[model samples]
Target: MDDITRDLVTLRDYWRYAISRFNKADLSYGHGTSTAGDDAAFLLLDSLDLPIDALDPFLDARLLPSERKLLAERIETRVTTRKPSAYLTGRSYIQGVRFHVDERVIVPRSHIGEILFREYLGELGSSFLPDPMAVESAVDICTGSGCLAVLAAKFFPQAEVDAVDLSGDALEVAKLNLAEHEVEQQVSLHEGDLFAPLAGRTYDLIITNPPYVDHEALDGYPPEYRAEPRLAHDGGVDGLDLVRRILDEAAAHLNPGGGMICEIGSGREILEEEYPHLDFVWLETASSQDAVFWLSAEALGVE
Candidate 1:
């Protein structure tokens, strides 16, 4: 770190050094980034309060002594502590939408964001959703930092969103994000189990990325994943406990023509085996084919 302070003057220099250290440390990623290079760049840009995506412009810019010290500490901490970079910086992004985060919530990286983008803009437009404009109400179960709730509010600007979470700590973090995105008026936050806080409150659409990591997997998770709240990841014996609850109740909460989209991690097989009577429309994203699923109220057998 002392050598880095004297030698690394530009963001580019720090970027190279950070990547080297991150790769050598064999740190696990996937909190808004997937690789060593991306992780290094995200943390470096975030530490300097620079545009996370606009790194090229500032690569050559020199850093102050204060800035260098902060970067050094952050870089070392990321390698040694195994705490996710998002927790270190207190921020994360889903499809370029930023949200504040800490140990209180899992860093927002659900495939639902990709699907929501498609529902409104991609070729799949109106496939998962017939008309975004017609949607008057929606809910985001396991809202965490409320990233999906914010996206839902944007995608369906006319809809009122109710976001639910069992953790008051997570809901508190979500409060900051709701205010940060200025969707405070459109999205309401509730603290309770999935759909528990929204009893009798039906909606035109429902979205959830609940805790779906089974206990077996949770035990083998590296320090980076384990650092997060166990309540956010433990999905019971099969990682589908919360998902099943949402699936069982979502149709009742949705309008007859409405639908639900859920991210179940890798539980597609488990779900199919359990619910053989229903067809789960698996949605494909850049990284995975079975990570998310969609089913309309009619499919869920709602009248």
Candidate 2:
């Protein structure tokens, strides 16, 4: 608590100091947008007495003495413990959409957010397959916190979204995120491995950010990996375990002319070498990730 005014001011000042120290650590092997310091501040702010929306306004105002101290404690706990700020706060954001997350699901950081939110995908004017009246239905296979599924629904309001995951806990978190956006009724949460719950259903688009880290890469990952679910990080020996499986099975679930897109991590080169027989287009994003690829049902040899 602050000595003069309130606890909020004290917390904010303390977090700013803690974040500086955390970011100085080595984080070369992990893929996270916010520095440790940035995360620490977020954690501190989340532990406050005010409404979540008050964060921006509070930062704009001068801090009171008491608010400073409480924030310091929050920062110290997170920085010293080496936990993610998203886990500490139970929330994370991608493309300005807030998601409820926990240890059950990896933090949402899909580069697909750039494409989906920015509407870089093809126009729906010519789309009439799923239904002439229906815009475009989508499947978020390997959906973790269901961030991409929600994004799909937002971008394609006329279409419904189905979010499928193997982890029940992760789906629970995903359900909350879908509901938070008032699209819970629109999104169907299915529990099963990728494309398993999908069965004979077809979609205009299938998206995934499946586990694609090679065993060696996982072994050498920075300390940040220790905080995330290993199931979401380890992609087997060559990192193509899940990617290959997805590519092989996804074609069966896509409508004719429909495609599947996945974030393949560093396995892009290996995939190219392994699947020279297939035709796929690897999409480039402003996020600078190179492994995202899309394959049509016909190109992948699926009926």
Candidate 3:
């Protein structure tokens, strides 16, 4: 073992080393983390079973010899495999809530998560939907890892949640998360193409973060992204194959006074140009602006 791995004495030492190794590898990020430093911190914390966000407080704390060995292997594995720290650690978090994750599903990093917790929870005073307690039914389509569905259930406790995903394997991962959150009673999992299995069912709220990456982007995905299942990110030639379907069919599946919030990454301009007649209300979050949109049943022409 190297001197650092053999003699490193503190979490701070491991933290700095992880950051350097990650940066040296030029590893691609985006699955819940955006930079080498962020990935390093998460990997170290998760491996040690410590609080993920409470790192600085523990940085100067001494590390056990076994902890040092574990961190060393993990830091090297991260650089060598280029796997997202979420997958490496078998966990991911959104809005302070943790979810079990794996290669079966894409890492949960939707901006809709912020809107659900911030705006819908009234931190920013949501203007699109009714109060959480007033909502009776909701759906999370393309519910990879079931992160958003869990968030929806937690944010709107009284509402019944339906989480749908096209990949049965992805649904398996979602199942773990739903159960982990103790929302199996509140959130139902369905394996099928979007809305196909929800026939004759309408929801008061809908939140979807579907596969919206264009073909060009998919073809060029770095190792980190390519590690995830293709079904979670492939949005077809123009990246709107499923989004178009949702826009076309959502009106019929929405109850009176209901609305849908969806994440489309970079499809804002194309969506605006293609569906100019529909009044789409773009939403902004702490890290994203206009990447998500809100559509109401009335605007969708509920029949």
Candidate 4:
């Protein structure tokens, strides 16, 4: 082992090293973290086989020689390959729930998961749906990694969830996560474009975090983003191509009082301009505002 590796005896030392490497490499984040320090913590804690949330207890703990070597290798891989930390760990969490992720699917990081767990439709109030438990069925379109689908099932235990994705490979990853969360019995996986596979099926609620990254933005995304599946990020010219189709067809698949919630990732302006006649209730989370919207069946002009 190198002298530098030997000197990384404490967890804090390794963490500092990881952060330095991440920053120097100019890595792009947002799969689960927004900064190099946060990403470094995840990678370092995961490499040590320690619970990521329980860092306070082990921050100064000393690392074994073998552990130090493993962490060094992982840090090197992180800097050299520029893969997202989630991909490096092969796992990700949404609202404390764990899911499997790989190149087959985009890393699961959506504010919709937070909104679902909160069980409160922001700005729309009770008129949208007074009680989340009343939702008998839900569908998660473009359900990459099935994180949102699993979250929906957990949030509304009585609701049966259908997770749809255009890529079969992504569905395979979702299936693993569904089983991991033990929601397979309640959540069904479908492989097809948007609502095509659903045919005559409708739901009490339909949620999606589709590919809303515009072509221009996608072209400029950092290497970390380029590592993910292209089909999961490209949203065409204005980033509203798929969103337009979804809005056009969502009303038909929604129950009378049902609603549609979606994450547009900064496409709110385009959405408002394109559908000026509709009233969209923009929802806010702790980290974001105006990135997600909810529209009731009535607002969507569906009976």
Model 1 lDDT at residue 76: 96
Q: Give all candidates' CA lDDT scores.
A: 0.90, 0.71, 0.88, 0.87
Please give, for residues 183-298, the per-residue lDDT of candidate 3 as tens digits: 99999999899999999999999999999999999999999999999988999998999999999999988998999999998899999999988899988888778889999888
lDDT of 1 by residue, 113-195 (tens): 98777668866566556598889999999998889999989988899999999999999999999899899999999999888
User: What is the model-wide C-alpha lDDT for candidate 2?
Assistant: 0.71
Ranking by lDDT: 1, 3, 4, 2
Q: Which candidate, 1 or 4, would have the higher lDDT against the true structure? A: 1
Q: Find the candidate with the highest lDDT and give its number.
A: 1
lDDT of 2 by residue, 1-303 (tens): 234234334444555556566666543222334555545545656665444444556665565555555555555556566666667667777765678888898877787786554443456532222232354778998898999888878767877789899889889898888889999877899999888887788887788999888888888765556778888887899888988898777767777666676888767778878889888676777756576776766786656
- Per-candidate TM-score against the hidden true structure: 0.96, 0.83, 0.96, 0.94
Candidate 4 local lDDT, residue 252: 80
Tell me the tens digit of each residue's lDDT in model 4 across 1-303: 488687889888988888898888888899888889888888888766778777678889988888888888888898999999888889888877778899999988888888776655455545444367798999999998999998888777889999999999999999898888899999999999999999899899999999999989998988999999999998998888899999999988998888999999898888899899889999888888998999998898778
What count of clashes does model 1 give?
0
Regions more than 4 Å wrong, model 2 = 1-12, 23-37, 44-60, 64-66, 120-135, 301-303
- Best of the two (1, 2) by TM-score: 1
